[model samples]
Target: MDLVTLTVDVVIALWVVAVVVGIVRAIKARPPRLAPLPEQIRNRFEVGWERISGRFLYEPQWAVGEADSLVMSLLSARGQPLDHARLPREMQQARHDAAAAANGRPRDKTEAMRQVLLQYRTVFERNLGPKPRRTAPVPRREVA
Candidate 1:
């Protein structure tokens, strides 16, 4: 009823509305979960990974670049953002190291390239790895 009380109530109500709006906006802005990769595409990625790993011993730098490319391809198939900043943190780091190696930067050390390949593997498996099988539940036995 009082002027001071009314002013304080209005401020509190406005603050609450602002907070709710912010939360809703954040929820809407989040990216949707990636759908499962099709079997054919998954198989192709697996074969590519096999070749990359096989070549690692003989050509570490090339293998790392291939691995990064494979992961990016997988992400593309899944409709993920290709922008470096928009990619997942693990992917961004792997991509950075892969670029460095390809450009002959200091991080192009053999051991570092190996680590980059491993990082790419992590992303690859997360997106294309075998999904867990679901077993059917046993039916209940009838009482005698």
Candidate 2:
């Protein structure tokens, strides 16, 4: 074959290999599915969610503690190690200061509370079961 034809062939072969590798990696990269939550634990998480959602706005300190408590509870129920639930050092200090400050400012407390809520949700979901699938909302049919 001519030099130009030989180069073209090589390039085509490389392109095909690249495409196949990309497809294979894409397939392997999919997240592993999580198991479903047990009914009892799901109920517990739901209750905790309600309490935190209700009180977080008005009572930031209490909400932060509640979030931590919820994570602890889930760990207890699952018989997991407790250290996994502990807040980071900075967060711990922030929480402590928030507690000590009489008439604590909500701004500082709110950031800590938000972190706690995020931690709780992550820990709760990890222990509870597989991630829930998100479904698209169904469109309503208009009557003619």
TM-scores for all predictions: 0.71, 0.46
Clash pairs of candidate 2? 34-130, 35-130
lDDT of 2 by residue, 40-124 (tens): 6778787887888688778866776776677666655655434523433433454454455425465665675665566556655
Candidate 1 per-residue C-alpha lDDT over 23-52 given as tens digits, one digit per residue, 9 for 90 to 100: 998886676577778777778889999999
True lDDT of residue 115, candidate 2: 59
The pairs that clash in candidate 1 are none
Give the C-alpha lDDT of model 1. 0.84
Where is model 1 more than 4 Å wrong at Cα?
A: 1-10, 28-31, 100-108, 131-144
In angstroms, give how far residue 53 of model 1 lies from its true place.
1.3
Instruction: Please list the C-alpha lDDT of all candidates, in the order they appear.
Output: 0.84, 0.64
